[model samples]
Target chain A: MIQNLTTVWRFRHFLLALVRLDLRLRYRRSILGVGWSLLNPIAMTIVFALVFSKILGGDDLTRYVPHLLIGLAVWGFLKESATAGSRAFLQSESYIRQSPLPLGIYPLRVVLGQAIHSTIAIAVAVVVTLVYQPYQPEPTDPLAILSIVPGLILMFLVAWSAATIFAFVNVYFQDTQHLLEVAAQLLFFLTPIIYTAGKLVGKAWWWLELNPVQIILELIRTPLMKGHPPTADRLLAGLYLAVVMITLAAGTAAWLRKRVIFHL
Target chain B: MAKIALTDVSLTFTVHQRKRVTLKEYLIQTVVHRRSISTAVSVHALAGVNLSLRDGDRLGVIGHNGAGKSTLLKLLAGIYPPTVGTREVEGKICSLFDISLGFEPEATGWDNISYRAFLQGESPASLRGKMDGIAAFTELGSFLDVPVRHYSAGMMMRLAFSIATAIEPEVLLIDEVLAVGDMAFQEKAQARMKEMMGSARIMVLVAHDLKTIRKMCNRAIWMQQGRVMGAGPTDEVVDAYIASVTRTAAA
Candidate 1:
């Protein structure tokens, strides 16, 4: 574990380069460039808000739009990143075969790139909410500010582990790629991004507790949107999951690092 | 003192030949560990091959396909850990085993170059400064801004080879990469490699072009069926390897 960390630290620049490469490649040929980062989520939020506000008639959705946007941005980042990153090693196998750098940097780069894209999404949410929604500044909500940084960190860890673990599975089973897409889609709906846990306050509430994404959603949402101080439980849960996933991912990567070449 | 040392190094891989695709059979196989003798077998890619290369020694590797020539290059580059025994390498090693392997098909030629270089351990700062030189060397010219996916196989190899040799690695591990590109480009690349050799570094060249090997390498190792058949002066090893191939063909 220490060895992995040391290796990642040494190749920190490669991770940054990967993030830059991802961003450039993302909007390279597009007319909108980085603006699409915001446009994508806002567009989805508009569709959701219009449907929920007009057809469903939910209570004052003015706040809910920004809330939903933030949640979706975070969740979308996690979902798409894991999906893309799961194939990180496979995709970069050529680079791995040619270059002499440490292998972990590729997965880490995948996470960092997604984190940057997600940050752009979050910035869009902030802009839309502050300008149009009349959101009053809540200076005392340190959690809100903390959310910006830690949310990215947590998302990165989740993405790193998800992509790397899937890399292992992808090597052994090519069909795992389709399975991953299905799994990500299911996870998106299962997580309480579209609605609150209170809405499901019934026999099916246990479903929320069982979801690993619940803590992740709450981790970002509690500090960013809800403006609630990060409760000890939420912090502990986030930290615990991050530690566990990182260890598992690192262990799997180490075990599969050299072996993956043969399989390829 | 900078050298690559392989001591009793062996690499074994499990070869699974899928004969039929059935979920029930797959589950049963997973649970029961039942296997038909024909479905799968274990194969050794490299079997306890030991070698040592000191600085300034150009070692050539000649082998038939699947005879572990590429595996040896990968192990030397530290891309693979030996399944059994130890391999130690000391120096900055750069490998051109898979040219254009890491390239993003969607990215521009220049963009791919930087990304590939950064992956090869060139600092971003260095890559930024060296981008123009790499582009010039490849003569990719106006195509630098074009997406790499549109490049032909030869174009891809040109770009890959140019970007790989841009860095001055102390130990270079190449597998059939020098055979890439047009004759002019090949000459330029060979000249660059010759210049690089003057820096007194080790190079492991894996190729079937015996003439080029004899020209570039001082010593050569012939491998057959995952074991070293012969190792000595380049001409002698090449002669023996050719004789063995002739004997096998005659029989």
Candidate 2:
């Protein structure tokens, strides 16, 4: 599946075209236009902060607002990418059933689009964080911008693989659509997107440490938010986890390549 | 020479059929038969069929629906890998299996054409430049800016046919798509197809129109019940296939 990375490069126009459609049609009738991208996260953040931090006996989470915003921005993109990627082919069955593309590329496009949307949110988050608490993030934290490159790459892989795998699975199983949704919902809480590892005290923290999403976001957030470089060891561990997810996704793509047309 | 080669290529599909599930049956199937399940059938869509094509060969395939004509075209186009035997082809191939396969109906004519052209294998930058040309060919005029779903079926076929043929692939596989358009569009499409044949390309056409096949194709293959009944020059092959069908119906 990876052999054709350059093939997709050749279809750069198709990818850009899809990205244009995704952004354009996403809120066509809605009045807000692209402003909705910024509005959604800000609204969600305010609601979560008000509901969880204030209404519940939640601790002072003012510092956690930026943290939560960052996590949500990343998670929202990842989740949306996964959701879109998995359904890309099924939604575009009219196209895939006829045209000759690698098929794996469609899901990758969904992820890239989602990542672009996430980037917008990240930009919004950066501005909002600085405005709310200018003194907190260190000057060195701008180096964290470098983390975007790796984050984007990993996000693309996850989206590509999920889309490719699901494109086949949903066609064959039909029930897999529901199964994946349930699984995605479960994975949402397992990852420390809403709360931090620091919040979980002591011996019980092992599960949080084991969560790959935690490691991935930390690799991203530490450099950008704290102005500190993520340790070499943590980066390696995140890369290892990413490799496993990508391999599993590729395996599904190889298995499904021939089978996809049958379903179509 | 630009060509497509199929050496004893075949494809079989395994389909799993489930017991029709009511709410109760669904629960039982999920809970009890989750692992030990037994309800499926296998279908063989294509049997070993050898064929080869050189540039300028417009080979027509005629058969009943599901007679593997489309399957053969797909294999030649490299959309489906053959389950057995080798299928090889040289030069770029474009397939028009369905008239509206690549268009996003909700997208504007300009955006969808650019996207569809690229998916058909044109370079992105080139597709960008060719967008106007594609739209102009559609004859949709200013309506080209509107979403495609608003267009009638004839209009959609015109747009799809225009974008597909615009790329001028070295090998072109076309299903029975031209039948959908109006007479004028059909004439235009036929002319475009004839123009394409004059170039260095192999054309594999699958159609129910025997007259059109006779007019356009140099060679023809007639398929029946997943087997080839006759293969030769267009008139000879069509006559043989008709006689066999007549005999079968009489019997």
Per-prediction DockQ: 0.41, 0.46
TM-score of every model? 0.86, 0.89
Write down the lDDT of every candidate, Cα atoms only.
0.77, 0.75
Clashing pairs in 1: A94-B101, A95-B102
Runs in model 2 lying further than 4 Å from the true structure: A51-62, A131-148, A175-177, B15-31, B34-39, B249-251
Best by TM-score: 2
Per-candidate RMSD vs. true structure? Answer: 3.7, 3.2
DockQ measured for candidate 1:
0.41
lDDT of 2 by residue, A165-204 (tens): 6756666555665666777788877777776667677775
**Which CAPRI category fits model 2?**
acceptable
Error of 2 at A188 (Å): 3.3
Model 2 chain B poorest ten-residue lDDT run: B18-27
